[model samples]
Target: MAEILTLTALGDNYIYLIVGAGDAVVVDPGDAGPVLLALKGNGLRLVAALVTHHHGDHTAGLAQLKAATGCRIYGPDSRCISPLDHLVRDGDLIDLPVGFVRVIATPGHTRTSVCYFLPQTEGGPPSQPAANARCTRPCPADVRPTTGPALFTGDTLFTAGCGRLFECDAAAMHRSLAKIAALPDETLIYPGHDYAVEDYMFTLSIDPHNQAAQQALRHLRDAQAQGRPIVPTPLAMEKRTNLFLRTDDPPLAAALGIRTDDPATVLAAVRRRKDAFQPS
Candidate 1:
């Protein structure tokens, strides 16, 4: 049984706890206030913390969580802003009792930004026997453990939007997003915000004729009305609707008047346009 608990933090950020099979691990606790509430509320014992980047909104409460729960933290060595218990890099897999999560170095959202991909507990080479399965005495196919992966995309990808290129150039941001866009369609895309609906409107303004944005807006509206999560977008879904992920398309280039087909060039134009978009 794999469970990911999400805690709302600092307005839009999401602090995630990937739990199951008797162990629990947290991914980016922006503050201890909400995390403590989540732990106590859900009766969960945090085993570790994964920091995707060093920004305070992502790490401000790390020290306190460690003080309170004594959870080990995994992050980049360059600067997690919080003190690191385990410094990891690209291609390294950290072993937990239940399974393993690989670190994919995805810089651009920040110089140290990295994404964690958690492998499912079943059907890979040799399935890890579920000490106890949750769905049934014998887990069924539909309820069988997911065999793909789950991604915790911090500030890099939002619901229908991407993070602002604060420190990294548009080119680097585009490259980083491309890496994320290549993941399997089934991979869950948990992001750091609940800011999808509004951002989708802004994005729509840039491409008023875009149908996918309209569909995403409708989806976001319904999810918001029902108080649901608007993220964990599939890779194929992102390729379909996310303007930032489609920076090289001709319509996008035409929108920005850029002639180059290079991904970076297209990113420059898109960012330039969004950076100038002001609500009327």
Candidate 2:
């Protein structure tokens, strides 16, 4: 089983270090300094680095980490980002020390954006569904254990929100989100940025009376006040509160004054509204 270590880098970006099995893998190393320190602190050897997209914030540390640790870099085939050691696409499985990662293409924020899905493996702390029903499992004192399958969503999907469309259209983004929504509800989501508080606040603006969204926003506010991370949210909770995931709901159409039947149309309208929406 792989133990995931969350390291905050570049202000809001999160870099994950997966240790266990026999080797270690780092995902989206935005800075070489923090990643190197974390590896040394844990006495772990870096064997590989997984990249979810070509975004500089996600790949800026790739070259440095690769040089220092000789870790192989894996990312999309797009030329916009740094050269990758291994070009990955949809459905490709990459092996690591603890567990293997299944590559899922989720292009919307960028044409080459992708997400890494790690299946649940035995080894970490016992599953604590109640505690982690809304946020990522807290790191244990010792080496963390595998809780279950975790999704490393790089700017494609955030808690209660989604990424800006820089490369694809609303229809494409809707399709990509549908793929993630189809995953088992228990799947844990590790977003690239710590945007839960802001995103949840935005949700409240659009869905003022939504009990689930309201309660979730309150819980997130408390977590923030306590300096607790609001990420690694459960997919189940996201399904309940994420406005982007509810493009098909009739209420969304009514609220946005859009057609109800076509998911893509509703999604497009919502995205446009969000782009211009100023959170009060």
Candidate 3:
């Protein structure tokens, strides 16, 4: 499995470095200074860059990094970003030095938005144990596949919030989110920004009685207080705690005045409310 490192850039934006076998690939490098430092410190070769969209905050460092490291740039075809070495669409598979990533076109925040899915490197069917060995022993955290297949949601899915619809309509965004929702429960999600606390606070206001939301909010708040990074949320946990993902739930629908069971409608309503939301 590749070791993932987070480089905080452009304030809240996150830049990810996937390192394995002395080779590395950067995801959405909003800035180059931190990435250069990380590469120098780790002594890893920058092989390629994976871009999710054309947003400047996500691709501003592309030119500089490519110049310094001679890394290949991969992204959706767009005029906003220049000198693309490869144009990827949905279901495209990108082979890297470590593991491969499958492209998922998730166009909600922008028309060209895409997501990258990398399956966890370990934890398939358990091996047969000895006749006298216990079959129910829990796996050690160190041995477990914590770096399992992860999704790089550019500006589409935040921790508890979804991105603003800049180039697509609500229906399109809903379909895009649905694609993400179909992934395995264990798929870890690494969004583009560190908006977990703010998104959680907004969720608490709407669903104050939601235990999962309350717990997640408290956990994020504590993490923030401790200066820990808040990201890579599990898909199963997000399915339960994220209000944006729960728009189709009957209780949430009712709370949001969405009488119809249509998921797009409910999601649109919730999104509008979020757009106008002000955290207390």
Candidate 4:
């Protein structure tokens, strides 16, 4: 029984709540108000907080959350918030009942950017095609593994689009992304923002005829129409479609004038295009 909850925050930001084994951890509390409210709604306790970076959008709620939940805070010392309970770095492993949660020190998006790779069973991809006759197209079984991890990518990888490279160069960001992209394709992703609307738009811009992205958009449309958020994107889907993660794709790299193996160059070109792109 693995449960990952998402709390809406300022604008596009999200506060993640994960019940890990015996403890509960919240990753990247963008703001306190919603977190507090969400905790109340879930009837779950918050044991600690994992901050991926030091941006205020990610840490602004720390002080208030601490006051409210009394949870210990852990983050990169580089982006230290006062009263830092614990500090972890690259190659650090945190024990949780779900399994040994490995801390992947992924920098570039930020100097201290980190992603939690929890190697537990992914419940399943949201049953996209079902009784709905119009949506009954089956997803590839080998492509989307229903059981695996949850990548808490804070402001780094979105549902479709990647994050804006603010602190690191495009090269570094691309490298960090490549590392995650190399993970098992079925690993589910829990990004720090809800950018599905705009992400699908960009997907259309770069790969206008991308069948996968278009299918996802349709699934999302059905979900939203039913008043639900389309999230927990499968890593397989990201690999197949996200330009940032798919820079390794032969056709995608060719489009960017880069070798599929050259993550840095492909990333730089993608970053430039993303900068100039306006979702149509």
**Best prediction by TM-score:** 3
TM-score of each: 0.85, 0.90, 0.90, 0.85
As for candidate 3, its clashing pairs are 118-149, 119-149, 120-148, 120-149
Evaluate model 1: give its lDDT.
0.72
Please provide, for model 4 over 98-178, each residue's C-alpha lDDT reduced to its tens digit, 9 standing for 90 to 100: 456677777776777888877766355555522222212331111122255778888778898787887888777877887
Question: Which 10 consecutive positions of candidate 1 have the poorest summed lDDT?
Answer: 135-144
lDDT (tens digit, per residue) of candidate 3 on 1-280: 6766667888999988877777988999989888887787667799999999999899999999999999999999657776589999999999999688899999889998999988775753222212213212321101112346788998999998899989998888899888999998778888999888888888877888878878888877876686556767888878987877886789988888668888888888888999998888
Cα distance off (Å), candidate 1, residue 181: 1.8
Whole-model alpha-carbon lDDT for candidate 2: 0.80
| TM-score of model 4 (CA atoms) | 0.85
How much is 183 displaced in model 1, in angstroms?
Answer: 1.3
Q: Is candidate 1 or candidate 3 better by lDDT?
A: 3
Please state every model's RMSD to the true fold in angstroms: 5.7, 3.8, 6.7, 6.2
Better of 1 and 2 by TM-score: 2
lDDT of 2 by residue, 1-280 (tens): 5667777889988888877844779889888888887776667799998898878899999889888989888888648667578899899988766577999999888888999999994433343323323223333212334586789998899888889999999889999999999987878888889877777777777788888888877887886686655657778889988888998899888888775688888888877877887766
Candidate 4: deviation at residue 199, Å? 1.9
What lDDT score belongs to each candidate, Candidate 1 first?
0.72, 0.80, 0.81, 0.73
Name the regions of candidate 3 deviating beyond 4 angstroms. Answer: 124-146
Please give the ranking of all candidate structures by TM-score, highest first, separated by commas: 3, 2, 1, 4
In model 2, state the lDDT of residue 31. 84
